[model samples]
Target chain A: MKKEKLNIKAALTLATTALLGCHNLAQAEPTEKDSWEFDAAFLFYSEVDRVSAGEAIFNAKKTFEDEDVLNLKLTIDALTGASANGAVAQPTVQTFTRPSGNGQYQVEPGETPLDDTFHDTRVQLNGQWTQPVSSNLTASSGVHISKEYDYLSLGLNGNLAVDFDRKNSTFLLGFSYFQDTFTPEGGIPNPLISMLIGDRNAPTWDDDFAKTRLGSEDDKTTADILLGFTQVINRRMLMQFNYSYSTVDGYLNDPFKIVSIVDINGVTQDNIYESRPDSRVKQSLYAQSMYHFDNVVLDVSYRYMWDDWEIESHTIDSRFRIPMGDSLGKESYLQPHFRFYQQSAADFYRPFLLEENALPTFVSADYRIGEMAAFTVGLKYGMLVNDGNELAFRLEYYHQTPTDAGFEEPGVLNDVELYPTIDAVIVQVTYSF
Target chain B: MKTKFKLTLLVPLIVSATGCASLGVEPWERDLLAKDEMSLNASPVDSALDDHIYFSKEASSGGKSFGGGGCGCN
Candidate 1:
């Protein structure tokens, strides 16, 4: 057998010791009595002098004797800080018009331009229902709605799981749909238009700003499908595999993002709003494995993804949990986590546009889709309280570094840092009773 | 390129065709697997929170969860 095949077979042997503890309604049985469970969490995420966010989430579930369960979730979050505007570094300070047209933001020499007015609050509400269809089959459906200051989204999803081989293996199929709307501040800018309008003393939409308006709002829709299985390979191991495909249509561009137009001398001439294809299709494969040893547990997962935009990515995540022994009391443990991610730049991705070249139909300067690699290191501590209650604290650090595209840098561009590294810290606390 | 992409999709089929009869334990021997720590989702809330953070920071998302929770952070 080939090495890949051998590895798959070996992993299969380590599959679903977790079948007995399955909790996703795929293996739930009718409850003998009505019962309720609740969980809540708080999270804080901070990017070095960039953005900071705080979120609160609550989830509750109700189990009924009729072989059905109802689950509800609520999430509220607020974010504040500066965000990149897709402009490249320059040898001298630069001043650019903000999205509202009536204001301006300045960037220091050799620094990426950022819009300092980025801030928003969002709320999401969700409901889910699951029912056992037969002795070995379960079905579930859910709906969710989210609202932000400038964006709104509504979605629905359904899933079905069936078991076979004396409950040792299960197959799952699911589908989801989402409809979203964008109502950006000061309306949406026309794609590829020079968004720079010089400094204006008046606080009103000037003629230059009016000429750049495309519309007041735009709409987007997405359809996604997933197929996968979970298998119990042995008493000590569990494994899962999944394949997903999705198609998205309509308004895929960021209204606030722009690309710098530069001359051969590497001097920025103007900043123009970016454009992107209206439709996209993507496919991905994922695998996960969990194993329990004499005293520790190991969990690992990997994902491979590709898209019509020519972007491809690979991600690996792993965690090892070790008990704290009698020193920390019962049910106390420390878990260490490591994650690595890498992605190729989109087909039309460019750090900046060249004034001597023709404009492409689709183009963007967003670094998120650019060639990059990111990694995370984290640790978590969990302790049992009052026998049935639990408390957990987790701290993590994330860093991402973008690479230069294979483009010729001219004049002053050679010395500038076209790709800046992004760094962030994450902290979370959770409780269950 | 398309053919190469299709190869990754064969992983599930290969896994499903492997030996199964002796893979798992009997129903009565599920004591260890039945523990709370062995649950498929040991911590649902933590998983969700991690997903949220990664989704907001990365360009690629979606494997174990649904799609279409759009945000305006861009």
Candidate 2:
């Protein structure tokens, strides 16, 4: 009898042990590879260059900026494969033109004033690997290589994430280092001489202005750090916040560009080549919130950004996805988006130059500076194609105008409209396997 | 300027308020939401492309994304 009782107790103990082991196995965390997914896409943009409302104001110049742009991408994810998990390859091609003739030359009678058009192509590759050390901690590292018409960049990034509880909150810390090489096509030249000649063949042009090579090569390094948090306030709302800081040092000039000077009589001409400031620091804070109420989703986000170059910007963005009731025997949805943005101009942003002025180290004639306000309205439609496929289309229009600060002289430099309204259309199709 | 500011604030508030009122749906009725079309960012690639174009042409950046290199476009 004693032996039988002992045997029964042992059997019960073994069964309990087996059950506990199974439970632990079931609750074990998934490997990094197991949670991975791969995605790739191709995108194209064809700008309608010839929309007319009247006698074209500026006889639109046909430059590289007028060409259609295309981008191709391939991303590979190893969910359960090996030490490496994520990789991406992206290539893009663009055609842009360099303006010729005096900056104000009119189209030669019926000559179709298009000048030089050059194709710029870029390719980039990135890869990342992740490892989990504990139930609540994970670490990841990544590397990237990018090459463009006049520049090459190599970068390394690392991140660590911690989950406080499996439930509703998480924290992420990350850092990135970037090293970039800028190599101009014809080498760097004296800014003033290059502008005065307007042609690359001038004998005064010097390739030595470039810090690195005969191609006018310059190198820059940047370091960035980021911290982010996501918290679920309740069952229906989620909020996230992120803060980032970045510092850049070394050569930071645009070698191919020249500064323009405007005389007292309002006549503009290209002058000495310009070099940009060698260092910049930027910081940003962002917050986003989403609420799920029944069938509707509401998303709102805000961002504040500041840079050491005396540029500060504020942005507010929001979107509402609404499912429309059956109006034409089909179910559809409409999503309207709105955004507001304002920024202080860069320290070196100038609409026109003073003849006898001391030139800054860096300057840009680009008009996006000067305070500006923009508004956007958009709509989207989705049509079910099959059980697992759908087609979606989106249309959005935006209009912007300069703000008070942008109009220093009210009627002088600001006479020409700085902001041009834009219209865009987006269409996509998706299939799930 | 005042008009623009009011318009900016009013439009979003009205939309959100109206949207909030009609937010709830039965679980089964959420079939539409379950469909990928209802996602706020259904097409990430297109969004990325649009963001790039706008970043290159306009004066703003950063909304609903992270971790892309900076350019001197602005």
Candidate 3:
């Protein structure tokens, strides 16, 4: 009787073990093969009579069996052409100091003053790794380094995301830091110094102006944080909202930019090195929504941004994609995009300083900090091939308009267009497998 | 700036709160949202390119991603 009872107990234990094993098998996820995705694109951007840039980029991503991911990206930017110099146009020829603050260049009458020494090539490399910590959590980290002729940036970023509410909602936290160094072709210039073409009171060209060698290098550091939330509104819709804050300290000024000092008669008195506040804090709130239907999809986003320099901006971007051939047994789609952006001028922005008044501690003529608006319209075509490979081509047009910031020009300068409209075209292509 | 921040905060709250009315979705119903085209950033490479272009041309930059990686163009 004792042996029979023991045998029965062992059988019951075996049955329970089998049932548990089956449950584990049912919960196991299907294994997938490691996959690779690649993307390559080239872009050409031009402004009417200002800077133009051509850039090429390549990216590759590898996904592992455990759902971890690795990404690599490389970029090459080639920039050339002339850039606007803060000096206004005059009835006669105007001579200005070169970007190097060493030599001089001449701009003819009825012409927009520009500096032709704007040429440089930049290369950047980035890598990222993402790992799943649990079924509902993920962590990712990335590092990047970029180099130009006179600038270098090294940065690191990390992110963590957690999902809740049965995977219907997710929360993300991210942080990034960067250290950048700048060493211009010539030494850094002292702020607010006279850069006259041929002033008898100034030092000779060969003497290497005393005010032009303040330092050989300057550095800046940036830190940022982002808090984001994403929720699935329904079976075909989802939305994401994020708020980010960033701070930058040290050497915020552009080494090559300058502001002109004009006399009452519109005569160029001097060109001084541009100066800006050494520290800046910026914040932005962004929201995006994506909706899907049987044959089409829509994406929309908006951003509201503000900075310590009293610069505020608004952005709206939208895209619509329609599957043209999905119902006909073909894999192709068309997408149209629209984007609008507007920004307020910085408090310290100045087109040019008046020689009659005392110089302010900080001033800059960079057009980017001025009141402006831009719009872009674009279209794209995408096709999916066998083996999950894809190709896409896109084209876009951009237009920019600048508003007046209460500038008081003298003489013929009053008639000159202080802010000229800029028109540009962009073409892009991408391939991924 | 603080007022702007408060306004920004309120808009998303109202949006998300209204979204809560239809928040719940079964796992099987996610087939449509699973498509690559439905992703918030469908083409990351293109997005990065556009971001760089805008950052170089505009004064204010950070919105979708962290602000780092300084450039000399600005």
lDDT of 2 by residue, A1-433 (tens): 6466445434543453364352323423323322112223333332233111100000001011212111223321111100100000011111111322222222222121222232345555655556665767777777777676666778888888787633346688888888888765655544334343333454443332232222456688878888887665544666778898878797755544444465554334334444557787878898887767677778788888778767787878777777765552245556677767777876875644566676665665444543566665666555433332234565656555545454243322333332333343333332211
Q: Which residue pairs in model 1 clash with each other?
A: A15-A233, A15-A237, A15-A238, A15-A239, A16-A231, A16-A232, A16-A233, A16-A238
Sorted by TM-score, highest first, which candidate order results?
1, 3, 2
Of models 1 and 2, which has the larger TM-score? 1
Q: Rank the candidates by lDDT, best first.
A: 1, 3, 2
Off by over 4 Å in 1: A1-33, A202-205, B1-17
Greater DockQ among 1 and 3 belongs to 3
Q: Report the CAPRI category for model 3.
A: medium
**Model 1 / residue A34 / CA error / Å:** 2.6
- Whose DockQ is greatest here? 3
lDDT of 3 by residue, A1-433 (tens): 6466444434533453364353333323323435445677888888777778988998866566788887878999989989877666667788877756567788988676888889999999999999999999999999989999999999999999999888999999999999999898776777777664665345475465644667888989999999999989888899999999999998888776778788887666778888899999999999999998777899999999999999999999999998888652348888999999999999999888888999999999878898899999999888875444577888999998877777778766686667877788888877664
Query: What value does the lDDT take at residue A358 in candidate 3?
Result: 93
